[model samples]
Target chain A: MDLSSINWLLLIAALMVGATPILLAAIGELVVERSGVLNLGVEGMMITGAICGFAVAVKTGSPALGFLGGALGGAVLSLVFGLLTQVFLSNQVATGLALTLFGLGLSALMGQSYVGIRPPATPKLDLGPLSDIPVLGPILFRHDPMIYISILIVALVWAVLFRTRAGLILRATGESAEAAHALGYRVIRIRLLAIACGGALAGLGGAYLSLVRVPQWTEGMTAGAGWIALALVVFASWRPWRVLIGAYLFGGLTVLQLNLQAAGMKMPVEYLSMSPYIITILVLVLISSGRGRISTSAPAALGRTFHAST
Target chain B: MLIRHLLAGAAMALTATGALAQDDGEPLKVGFVYVGPIGDGGWTYEHEQARLALVEEYGDRIETVYQESVPEGADAERVLTQMALSGTDLIFTTSFGYMDPTINVAQKFPDVNFEHATGYKRADNVATYSSRFYEGRAVIGHIAGKMTETNKIGYIASFPIPEVIRGINAAYIAASEANPDVEFNIVWAYTWFDPAKEADAAQALIEQGADVILQHTDSTAPLAAAEQAGGVVGFGQASDMAEYKPSPRVSSIIDNWAPYYIERVGAALDGTWESKDTWGGIDTGMVEIGEMTDAIPEDVRQEAQDLADSISSGEYHPFTGPLNYADGTEWLAEGETADDETLLGMDFYVEGIDAEIPN
Candidate 1:
């Protein structure tokens, strides 16, 4: 293996760009699951956001508005799930799966005209002299705004999920909807709000894919990234900070493996190709398994439908 | 076994009705199962274009239907079965992964004709066909080799199938011949149409000093990446991505399946369709070299064109003799050419590729 040829700084920078989409989606899903609502329609919402973001960006020649469109697109689709599972008290698992199917079909139809069009480029942040610094600048400050936004979202989610009264109510609603209802907390409303927040963030993640990452619109372009985001949330034990680490680790491993192969590494390519998933799961699962408290991490009332009368 | 027998019986009944319907002078049904979205702007897009050409050529006499993004394996089997059950007269299973599924479905629907692309397996009712993509690869390899300032060429490969492996070797052989110091950096993406992954692979290669990128995957994501990393050039695969012309996409290897599609459909209409294998190259125009842009030096463009012409005229074979496997074992003696069987099952890289063919 020609190890010397692989540039470590650029690889790290690419990892952040690569992981931003999954990180965005995972952070959102973390919020939704924390509220005890399990929405598996993340893939669907993401693709919807992707197409919406691409279309809006292309039409307006603005990447920022395109991201707004993507968030709105995801929120609209998630609201469909919210109405069905929240107000109607439908089964969360089945509804989420159906939402995914619906989202894929809907996006395909919506993206028919938008295919092959390029979105306005999402520019990297200009940190002036800071960006001109050596290794740290390239690895940290030279990324597009979404990378910083994703990290900021993670911090925001961490603070809100653990530090605020609202966070406590959201956690209580997730733990026991009946008790939260008795405490006069609007269980259904809180869960619905959480679901929307998750959807909007997932949409933002999808937009990052179309606007910055792949930077083009293709049908089913989101591929399975939405599913990977879902897995990230579970493996990170629903901790916002762990989600950040897992996303970078997963993203880093993906870019690193490709770099390894390009550098003529003789290791089995299959192992290298799958190393991201295997190592990410191993590391996150190991970290989350602390104190034999693995089973207690998930919200107790997750996937349970709540009716106010009950 | 019982379920199989029952399905055969149902299919036979359906076929008998289908045959009777055809006797009434109905439009011939031509169904297609694609491995990616038609808008992928690469492999499947080319296939979709040919499908449209088939419709236009036959006009109202032939009807075309297609399902895009159909995953291979069991899902392919299901789609093929559905097409057969729908009284389709001829079905085209596109993609190498559809080999077994096409064979399995062809057995159940004996009356329906099946054409499997880029696959070796064939039944009595299944016909196999593929373009000489390696011939096109040789032409592009020459350009890539001549154009590279870094002498490092990155190849974004999809799967490790024989088809993909063949392209890698052909390109590497021609590339190293053009510039003995040129190197290939191959990354197996293990996917056909994942834009994000393709982009990542391209960037990784570019960062590692590769100034030219080539992809076997069915997306323009790699070219897009090369465009973003200024000065990196690439060729469009399967289709002419004119949007990136004059720079990143200096040229393209276009897969022209329309003429073949028209011929096969004509045969089916005239009742002369039979199982066979067709591997047409530059001579028959199954594979075309798209217009080279000004980005390619004039002399290099002429050289690439001459190589393409010689291959088309049968004076030059991409797998000509004097070649050695990556292990330095003698693969072809002087003036020898690779036989169809060995080329079809190619699994190793040629000499100087500096990489392993991943399983």
Candidate 2:
């Protein structure tokens, strides 16, 4: 209720911690979707990553290596999806769904011995001097390294998608595979690589949850963050900067609701908890409610399977 | 120290390995069928703890076996059958979801003794056992009522099952008893093993000024939430959550499966097995109270101990009479006590509770 007492700085810091998971997952999805492949299995990849990260971190006693293992574990599983969708020419949605169900079952089995045991504690970034500042100290100077890396990824993705010639080719392939193929681009190969990157990023997101945030390997740890990430990809209209905007918005909703409750607001906590999902749905509806043919910069061959015609 | 006891037990396990060839008169094989991973911080952890206690207590007398993360449907029956056929003299089906399968497995292997957790369907060879977890909730409700500065409490319920619903009512009753102005706000994650959602739910509760958070779902997320938000208090369900001590977790309702494990299977081992439905709480030793940490004020601490003593001494029944439905209609007669049968199949929420129970 008192503006003078409201710590906007801590609030921003909370926003970053909360947004990191989705950022990792969504950025990966952006690459995957930008390559003309739709991965409905992001949820599965994330869970598998969570378990693999936890197991590796617990075994190795290094959170950094655990994150690396998580990315590889996710990318490796996504390779299966890449093969089936790109080479095997299987239906993307069905295979992706199966990936989720299988991941759920597998993680449950693998995490059996790990209950109640705490993993090695993650170290927070100690911005020694800057963190000691009065107003700006905690916000910019304090965070897990994962938060910094995720934001860095947004910048890298933006540069790659908009500036690089390779980014142009990838975007061209997503827009029209036949055209890109005619120009001698390895369309399937490019798409597979993009999908793998997305998986690895999403894997990192899942790992951040187990290794740092909640810091426990829980079954169904991702909950619906993957779905929210999926909605975010569209909300951003598949642009990198927009992904950051969308991610932080959802993250803000998450943090703000908690802050509201902390400030003693009488809103039904249930409804406030459900706000992020509700707002995402509304955003999607607004995005989809436009004029004739929903005119926009959508990838030309999005969600369509391609086969090499003899 | 508990940690040393665990380590010493691990050491004893190595020595017990040599007696593998002795074959002490048709070896007593023990099989554990888990509903979730052994690593989860809630229900399965407690069950696994009991399994370890068995290993510590019996040493080489018991041969323990386990199949982790088996679901509670046809898979449970399959696992139970495999264990029974493999000479498992006793099988512990440790989930209420496994009740039907437990009963089914009991009928198939009449010689095997099955002890199920938190359910009441029993056969001649099958027996049921559970803690009056709701009773512990009442004691915390008293603490929560006095401890809460905002008069709002958050309850993260796993499922709308009778066991979890009963906990909600008990917590509400205690909270209201402590402060007539108290209110309960709930969020159903509808899952037994999700930390992210649990954290999100706890955050929502903490944001809304719920200084006390209670959970029926298994995990340390609520305690983690309490750590993030100062002044928030919580309890460890099914196990003593030692991870968060001193401040957030003041007391806990620890599951004591050792006695029941000894009682039910000891008879079956001695050839006196029979079917029975059992529910034991504070009055019995099935549920033991964890030590009160320093977070609790002295007055609240003494009051909590007194309530725990009354329950353990059989001088108190949490769900006593002069109770009313949510609509203010009388459910329990004045001065009337609810017997085990009525309490076992509890269906209505007494007055002062706000959440709806799914049919």
Candidate 3:
């Protein structure tokens, strides 16, 4: 692998595009986790979004509306998760797993007719001469809208989580639902909204995959991207900016491994193919070894069903 | 436990119905298990097409059932068992990964006929069948050698299985035969049908200056990637991806299973079916080379067509040698051709390839 042979700018550009989907999904998941909810159905929601987005784009010839369709589809599916866990007080983990399975099957069935059909192209943002600035031009300015939106979403999420009164109350609910309930905050409503937001973002991630990345709809197209997002949230320690860095790192590794293979690196292909996941797990392990400090970062009431008693 | 009891009850019911059907002269029940969705437009799509052809040929005499996107391990065993219990007389397990499950299920249902695709395992009731896809690969490799400007050909291999290995060797051999300076860059996606991964692999290859891409994985993503990269060329694998014709997709390797499917089903109906391995190639019309689009120069296109014709006429062998392993070990002497045994268990990369075959 000659260093000179690699195009650093193009690699970074590919990294950003690769990271966008995971970053979007992870940020949404971070919000959901912050609101004391663990929705493991990110994969399910994303795939549902992929097919719904692809179907709408193909039907309406509008990639923008297709993104809306994707978000709506994901939010709707999250509503089912919200209903099952919040209304019926079911175990969040099992319910999330069921949701994933349900979403996969539903998407496959919905996508049957949409398969082999191409969706209208999602256009890139035009920055004119600014986009032509040598090394930074292609890396920063020449990406589809969702790539920029994903980073903006991260910034917005970081600000909202730390700087707003609503953020305080949401954190309070996550820290102690009974305390938030005593303070008269609608904990269930807040958690439900967070879950919906998470679903919508995950859906957008899925949409980015179908409309721009692979740019086609095939059954089970998400291909475990949702699970990767879920992992990213945990690795990011529930922080928005960390999630951005983690997603890029993971995405960069993915792209780099492929580049290495293309460069005819003598290492085993399986090792290179699996390096991204292995590295992610290692980072997670290192962070988790921080023990109480790391454990304290997770929402206290996460994955627990909230029940109001007399 | 609930599913088990339910399956048992269903099996009992199916047994009674099957006996009555025999008395009532009912149609033959055929079941298909696919590794990917039927709309994949490649490997699984071709199998589904063959299933449809079976229906069209037999009409009311045959009734078909299929479970799409079935995974290939314990889940496959469960699905195969369910089909067997449901009184499916002939089952086509269409994937290399379904070998063990097919064999295990065939053992339980001794009377039923089982045909597994691209697998080596077989039993008294199970038969293995696959197209000689390497034959098609050879023609495309020749085209790639001639068409490539960079003299670097990228291959997106699925798994390190013998079937895929054979294709890599065949393509590399033919490309080198045409252009001695042609170099191969291979990336294993480790999947049969993930479009996203396949696309990413193609992009990496294109970025590394490969102008011609070949894929053993089933998806149009590679061709789409090649199209996006503009000057890059590619060939459709397993099915004719003619949609991108005249550009990135200059040609394709089509798996034509209809005739084989029709003949096998006919044999089952005639009670003449027995366990056997079938590796049909271009000569048998099982593996076809799709149309060479105008993207290829007229002379080169003719050369590709001629190569296909020679393979079809059994006048040429893609694996003929004096060939050697990548490690410089002699594989075949002068005028020697690879036998079915060597091809079936191919594990080494032929000379000129630089990558290791992942275990």
Candidate 4:
């Protein structure tokens, strides 16, 4: 296949669009992981945010506040996870699963009238003359602001993780809650805040999905992007920049297949559709096999419950 | 054997559950398995609407129970079996994905009547039902043909499944008829009920200058995306998205399940239930026209309504004769309605489309 046949610009643009859903989700997951917690309910939280963002936007007709509402909605819901795992000291996995189940049921119940009704639209940012350039124009400059924000969040997360003392403390907590606790760090509070942050980011991702990306709320609307985001945190090996690359890689796969189909390539269309998901699973399995001392980058207590008595 | 015994045990447990729910004697029980949430405003929503209608019509005579957003897989089979085990005399598995599970479960409960939606499979105990969604597609495709300035139309497709594909082809046919120059851009979200993805797909389609957007998915997101595009417009799928007034939503095609649902359940309770393949369309009130919005011009709306009425009145058959396959070979002759067998087993794209069907 000639590379020329591929709309690299459109491919890249689609990749960016695809990444916004994952970027928003993975960043939230990263924070939750950084705090020595794993919230498998990213999809649930995102869908909840999707419905909330969708409902609020349709009700209020403001996309900006709609995103904020999504973030808040996600954060608030994630707090239930925080409270369950942190305060009540429940099994994190079980709690996360329940969080997803509860989120699905609650969102469905809430999304009844919101179904089929389009929420208020967010305007695409146009750089005018700059958007007219070949290749580069559509690729880089012409997406909704949330696209740029996702990339910014990645960089900001990187800066926080590698450059800041607070980042070190959070990392330490993820590595060993007991050690971090010994250092006078409030492990529970740190994890709680991290989860809340992750929740809000996930909510933003979901909001971006409903308000900007898809811009409508339907039941179970996140469509496994949240799961992809969870997988991305692992794919990125907990590194923020890697999340960017990983997110875009999978996102590109998603975009490329569709573009190929749209360009009218004579390939088994089902294979094209399944390619992204299959490739991700293979890449993930490959990565997990070679990475043994994953805790180097991984916080020690990721997915493990912390007990003060211990 | 394990499943049979389990189903038998489930029947016993269902008796207990039913006994618990009723605490009194009842002759009949009904349940619904929804693939999407009742609130999704598409297929599941339509099914739920029918369930509500059944409730309204039958009142307390028929005890209906429903579980929403059930996934289509082993879980689906389990849920269907449970509904039957729960002593539901009639069960409606409302999704194309539920076909196999419906059949699988129906085989176990020979006495129980099962109606599987949008599938070809059937058993003595099971029946198949679907709408001529393609017929609806033709009218909207015609409208999109008339309305689009870019000569480009976007279709938000749910899956590559035949049911959805047929609608895409039908829309293409009607669109091409209205304006021979119109080309379609399809965005397959590969989901049955993810509104966020559906909306994103719609947005991308609109960004590509598709002035008219259509959807095979069951959310209002496409119409919403069309609205958000500042000037782009679209049609409603499965439900009347009349909420988006003034612009974006021009008209809608509603899939009505109430009349059929009322009939089937009534039959079941009266001991007249039998399994058969049913493909209902405009004539049966199974597919109804939505409120014609002001967005459509007077003449155009009149023309669409006329075509709809003709179809309902049996004056037209959407898959009329003189058609060609994607390979440019003739499939049907002019003025000959494609036999039910051909339309039911449709696997090829019709003439005048650039899309290639993948095996």
Candidate 5:
């Protein structure tokens, strides 16, 4: 195997790009789960965002606006889940699944005209002197704005979930809707807002794919990245920082395996193909399992519909 | 006597329609199960194009219905069963993964005829049809080998099926023949259609110094990736991605399934349909090479054209003698050609390919 040919620095840089979408989506799902609501429609929201962002970007020739459009699209779709589960008292799991199906179909229809169209390029953050650094610049500085935004979102999520009163109320509502409601916190409204935020972040992740990664519009282009993001949130034990680590590891392994294969690595391709999923789950489970059973870390009210009256 | 003959014909038509559970006046209902969205602009798009051609050719005589992005396992069987239950006279399951599902569904609906693409399994009512895409691959491989400045050619492969393996080997054989220094870097994405994954594979290849990109997967994502990474050239796969012409997409391998689809549908309509295996190539107009633009040097283009012409005319086979398996076992002696059975079930890499096939 020609291991020398594989550019290690470039591979590291690529892994970040690979991880950004899932990182963005998983961080959002962490927030939603933390707020005591489980929305399984991240895939749906992401695809909706992918198309909405792609169409807007193509029409307006601005990648930034396209991302905003994607966020709006995702939020709108999530609100559908919110309206059904929060107000209409529907099962969160079923609503989330239906949202995914609806999102996939809706995106396909909306993207009928957008197929094969290239989106305006999302330019890299040019940190002039910092970008020229030997080992760090290419890996950390040369990426587009979305990568930073994803990491920033994760950090912000960590801060809010731990430091802010709003985050505490959201967590309390998630832990016990009745207790939070009795304590004068609006459980349904808080859950709805959390779901919307989750969806907007998921949408932004999807936009990162269509606008920056693949940089083209195609039906179902988000593929299973949304599902991976969903899995990341759970494996992270509803923690934001852990979600980032899991996403990078998962995304990094994915890019690394492909790079290894391209480098003519003699490993079994099946093992290499599944390395991302296997390694990510192992590492995260190991990291999170230290505290005890993963279920203990889960929000007690996650997936439990909040009824203020009942 | 004339009136009697006409009456008998009408009675026979009536019986035929009754047996098929349809009226004689109704158009033939044809169902298509695609593994990807039709707008993928590659494999599924080509199949969708053929479906449209079926509509255009038969007009009122044929009615086409299709379900896109159908998963290739139990979901395919359910979709096929639903189509058969809905009185679809003929069904086309257009993906290699649909082989077993097509066979499974075909058994339950014996009255319905099934056509599977890029598959080997067949039943009494099931037919297998696929183009010899390797022939086109050989031609493009020659072009890529000649054009590459780095001598690194990246291949974005789908699954490790015989069809995909055959393409890689054919391309490698021709490419190595053209440039002994050329090295193939293959990455199996394990999917038929995921634009994001395919794009990543392409980017990975480009980053590793591959100047020419080749893909067995169905999507324009690789070409898009190649275009984004300037100086890297690639060929359009399954469909002529003409939009990227004059640059990254130097040429393409076009699958011409319309003629075969039209002929098969006509046979089904006339009650002469029979299960068979069809592996047509450039000579039969099943695979057409897209126009090689000015990006390719004149000498290289002429050489590629000659290679394609020779393959099309059956004067040369892509897998010729003096070849060995990756394990160094003799596969063919000097002046020998591969048999159809061997090509259909190819599982090993030819000599000089440094990578192992993922089982």
Candidate 6:
């Protein structure tokens, strides 16, 4: 397959770029699921973020504002789900599905005029001569700021979830909303905040996709990425660091298959195309089968309605 | 039995609406069903542009309605039925995946005319239409052949269907004609429109030492990838990606469906609409060779233009004889041109492409 011809440096760079969006979205979703809420609207929120980010970037000539706009848009859309599920006591599953449909339609409408317009460029981190450091520079330092931010967010989330009082309250609420409510924790409010945070991060993921990945706005640009993020949370057993590993693993498989195809590998293209999904599912199965310990790691109150009176 | 009753009720409701439209002096209602969003900047974008043209030509005489990003299958059938029920007199289902659904809906709405794009199956009330995209591929193949210093041409194929297969054969033949040493690396993306995947495929091709790239898929991602990779050349598929012109995108194959759209809508208005298959090529303006930028050498550009002219004039057929399958079986002998039936059901790769067509 002529493996020697491949530029390993460029390949790793592409892998990082490919994994960044999912990593961002997965980490956000990890926080949401950790709070015992299942938001299936990741796809919708991500797409909303994509169009919103692209539109604002094009309008203001600032990619930063565009990302903020994307986050705001996704958070606002998630509020609808929040209102329906938390306040109105609607079914979370159905409401989440509705959010996805609504987000897709709304994004398409908002992005209609923004199509074919390129967003403002998000400049790479200029590390001066440090970026020229042999092998590590290209792999670690030559990426856009968003890549660094995504990793930093993951670290921040890990710390917040493990080493703080608010983290304890949040995890306690997810473990038992009724008990937490009895203990004077605002269960609904905590879940609502988590949903918003998840939506915002998912929006950032979507923004990265449109503003940097493809660098153009198209309808349905998220294209099921949010759903993948949702699945990635479950695959990671709701752990923050595991989410990072899972995202990079999936991203590496995606880039590797394409590289294999480019290397003129004798395998059928269908096999190469389906390899990423198949491997992800296989890994999830393997992990979940490990003494059934990982499966029990799911938040005990996940997908459960939190009614104080009940 | 319940499903049957629902279908009957839906069909009756559609017929009732059709009758009401006839009673009222209403403008002809034309509907379009798109597989991708109109902003896809490729195949659906071209179709949407034609829809706009139809509106321009018959402003007051017709009302156009469109639903985008409709997935193929049961959802598509429901959408087509709903459009017919809502009093759409003529509908254009623009995607190869909508073939069966178009026929299914056409059966219930005999009064509504249906035009399915890039499909072969037709009914008494359904018509199929497609363009000769292979002709355009031949032109790009010539350019890729003469331009490739790596002697490796990467083709990002969408599917193994006959239409995509035909483009591969045409491109390979033209490329080989220019440079017999030219080799092909085909990657079947299995998707019609996914920008990230398309860009990745292009990157893979470039990394594999392919200096020239070709795509039958609908997206400008390949051109963008080529530009990002630096020095690699590609052609725009389905739309003129003029934004990346003169370097990475030296030329493009534009799908021009406006004229045919106007004509069919005109037929519906004149009460002369009928079920028929239309496969138009460069001559009828369905397939257009976009402007060749100055990046292509003058002689190569001129040769590409001449090839386009010949294909348009019917003097040159891209699938003409002396062709063999990849397995070394002779398919077409000397002085022989491929028949419509053979071309419509083509499933084998032409010789020189070192890849198997996935089933």
| Candidate 1 chain A lDDT trough over 10 residues, lowest sum | A283-292
Which one wins on DockQ?
Answer: 1
**Candidate 3 CAPRI-style tier:** medium
Best by lDDT: 1
Worst 10 residues of 2 chain B by lDDT: B18-27
TM-score of candidate 4's A chain against the true A chain: 0.92
Superposed by TM-score, candidate 2 places the C-alpha of residue A156 at a distance from the truth, in angstroms, of 5.0
Candidate 2, residue B277: Cα displacement in angstroms equals 1.0
Flag clash pairs in model 5. Answer: A36-A174
Tens-place lDDT digits, model 1, residues B1-359? 99999999999989877765774668899999998878778888899999999988988778899999899899999999999999999999998889999999998999999999988888889999999999999999999999999999999998898889999999988998899999999998888789999999999999999999999987888988999999999998899888788889999999999989999999998889999999999998899999999999999999999999999999999999899988899999999999989999999888888888776
User: On residues A1-310, what C-alpha lDDT tens digit does candidate 2 reach at each position?
Assistant: 3233235676777777788888889999999899888998888888888888989999999999999988988899899999999998899989988887777777777777765556787788887898898777788787878888898999999899889999999999899999899989999999999989998998898888888777676677777777788888887878888889889888877766655544445455567657767866766676567744423656878888987772
Put down candidate 6 lDDT per residue, B11-89, tens digits, no spaces: 9989877765763558899999999878888988999999999999988779999999899899999999999999999
**Between the candidate structures 2 and 5, which one is better when assessed by lDDT?**
5
Candidate 2 Cα outliers beyond 4 Å, as residue runs? A1-20, A38-41, A48-159, A162-164, A175-182, A187-189, A227-310, B1-24, B59-61, B85-87, B354-359
Decoy 5 TM-score against native: 0.92
Tens-digit lDDT string for candidate 2 (B1-359): 99999999988877666454454455588888898767666677777887888778777577889988888799998989889998898888898789998888888888888888777777777777777877788888788888888888888877666777788888887778789999887666667766766776677676656789988878887777687667788988778887678878888888877777767656655667676766777777778778888888899989988988897788977777788888998888877766767666777777886655544
| Candidate 3, residue B194: lDDT | 77
Better of 3 and 6 by lDDT: 3
- For A1-310, candidate 5 gives per-residue lDDT tens digits of 7788888888888889888888988898888998888899999999999999999999999999999999999999999999999999999999999999999999999999887777888888888999999899888898888888888888898899899988899889889999999988888889889999999999999988888888788788888898899888867778888898889888887888888888888777677657667755775666556665763787888898778777
- DockQ for each model: 0.72, 0.24, 0.56, 0.37, 0.66, 0.45
Cα-based lDDT at residue B223, candidate 1? 85
The C-alpha stretches of model 6 lying farther than 4 A from their native spots are: A269-291, B1-26
Cα shift from native, residue B81, model 5 (Å): 3.6
The positional error of residue B273 in candidate 2, measured at the CA in angstroms, is 1.2
RMSD of 4: 8.3
What local lDDT does model 5 show for residue A67?
A: 96
* TM, chain A, every candidate: 0.95, 0.93, 0.96, 0.92, 0.95, 0.96
- Please report, in order, the local distance difference test score of every candidate based on alpha carbons: 0.90, 0.80, 0.89, 0.80, 0.89, 0.87
